[model samples]
Target: MPTEINFDGIVGPSHNFAGLSPGNLAATQNAGTTSWPRHAALEGIAKMRANLALGLTQGILLPHDRPNRRWLASLSTDYASAPPLLRAQAMSASAMWAANAATVSPGTDTADGRCHFTPANLLTMPHRSHEAHETARQLAIAFADPAHFAHHAPIPAPFGDEGAANHMRLARSHGEPGIELFVYGKSGGAFPARQSRVASAAVARAHGLDPARTLFLAQSPDAIAAGAFHNDVVAVANEQVLFVHEHALADRDAAYAEIRQAAPWVEIVEVPADAVSLADAVSSYLFNAQLVTPPDGVMTLIVPVEAAGHPRVAAWLETMLAGNGPIRRVETVDVRQSMANGGGPACLRLRVVADPKTIDPRFLVDAAKLDSIAAVVSEHWPETIVPDQIVGTSPDLALVQTVSSARAALLRVLALEGVLD
Candidate 1:
């Protein structure tokens, strides 16, 4: 049997408001505000616990070290000597959004029958560009069994890869063959289009996916301008159901035709533009919700509180639930800290469909392990982090030490002390 495991990132100790992501509206709007790293990390852990309580498989990804010393050293600069902008980029805790970790092709979809993972280059933004190597290393450790898991280096640049954030897989069952939908943006009026056609095709080829079972589509330019930075912001899929905004794709009718041709059983739930405008969808992150199949086989939509708070979105969800559809219930999760940084429930995890027994046991989690992680966060994570404190010539260098110490405590708690090294 195939099991879907969610590997959620532990919000980093240096979590703060630097506003590095260009297309992320929340990040831009919340720029320079004080951030609560302790609360962020604990909130992340609570979300994982909630998933576990729902009988969903949960796993953890340790937070990447902030003041990314290695990335700084590569440029021959130290924290004290670097410019404030560069310093802020290096100290970013963007890795907390693991949805961009990698584009994964489960064994069921690959020709080799070995699960494939290609860590995203994320070359569009300086803060995220440094993530590929570290993410690759962590994925290797988590999926160590060579026979069942295959780890591949990120596709070279000029082709920006943003990982599973722009990719979605749909199948009748986790163990069955599935269609891999790759979404790329041609252009963003002001911001750079992060995912490219070349990168999407390359990832599909690298995973040895069957051409007949794969679909590559262009993301709507309008959606990108409306703060749909990644495809997940406007669309998401699970099993045979696809929940997407009307403006999610460039050619909605054609995309739907192709999807139906590949999987005739697909249920396309198109949220009408009149019911909830694209702007509202982006603001509420209505499509970023997690579509899951609980043990009872009824599909559930785990959404962020922001979605529930939106009057139109909430009303639309109620109408949808009242009808005969794959989504039977809608459950709300807090994740407010992540939300402030422009991520939602789906942004916090990387989903891998595989048999649990085949994966590295160390990455899996239970109630006791969640408690230990929460304890570490409470003990070492700072209540608030001021961006200015870690920035210029006379910046408070002690902030770096504090972040390092917190990461160390978390590493020990997760038994991944040297994982980053």
Candidate 2:
């Protein structure tokens, strides 16, 4: 006989708010209909944020350093699928004429902490007039054709459209050469993948993953708008997997339960409805701050965050850790403040990429000190220059130096005459 199951229990939701739906909040009864989407989005985002944090603490292998690189890799089919601002900038930049040719342009690498990962994108040819055509030619030559950079995967082609959106994450799966991806059809614009279903197959073949192991998850098969899936995938250890599922606008318990039961070894955790504050739909700070495990307990993240729901999120995470070696959160210098000034620690950093071990988290943090900066500039400035006066004059290194030197000379002349302030 099989051994009797002796399950301890999970700290997650018990009933899982089985009956509550975010859509049920009455607009007329609550605040107003205008705020419904905001509230609903926030509630859902809370759970999603929690999922990201949990996954991170669990060591889901997220790229800590090059966040943009990883984010962009998640897109391939069409840049237009991206948000308006992003799409606009991307299109606008590639409009240069010279960008059509295939030639490597100079680009700053990772050592400087700016943008090192996009080396192949160095060929920047700007265009005028026939902008779109020039961009296409340049991008093709620059990257050896769009298809070459198309995640190098084989996916099903949608009928008539001949394109499918395929998303890929590069990493080793612990067991079974299998992977699962979540893709949602985008509405309006052009989702070539929607008509072709090509991206799915493209993604599978590109990664050389087992066909059986690759599971494609997409919601709203018939919807015109691309939607975020309620499904948040987890990278599992062995034969077991767990996913916390909930529905929006509708009681998706049946659909969720079905998916849950399909994997006997997989446990389905339900989340409580009250987890999010209605004041906002979802909080990004809460999710990013959640401590997911380090895959091998090998990775340590040193994030410099400023006012990102860090306090409340950190407190909640600490309680959940169960004292298991406990996570350590190091708050480095405020990068946001730096970025607002058109620079960041990442921008100032010069990293030694030899061992990855050479990356001392303190290097950037140490460099952020105001006194250290003042000292570095002090040696470079003339003896007559005053650091405080230079700052008051301007932050421009050249301008500040010139003004300081002039002021310092006046001070020296006055001092020689016994005149002082």
Identify the candidate with maximal lDDT: 1
CA lDDT of each candidate? 0.91, 0.24
Off by over 4 Å in 1: none
Q: How do all models score by TM-score?
A: 0.98, 0.32
Q: Report the lDDT tens digits of candidate 1 across residue range 139-254.
A: 99888889999988898978999999999998987778999999999887896779998999999999999999999999999999989999999999998899999999999999
lDDT tens digits, residues 67-186, model 2? 122233445523324443322223221111121111110111111221111111111111111222222332232234222232221122232111111221112322222133323333
Q: Summing lDDT over every window of 10 consecutive residues in candidate 2, give the lowest-scoring window.
A: 6-15
The list of candidate 2 runs beyond 4 A from truth reads: 1-178, 185-198, 205-208, 219-271, 277-282, 288-319, 322-421
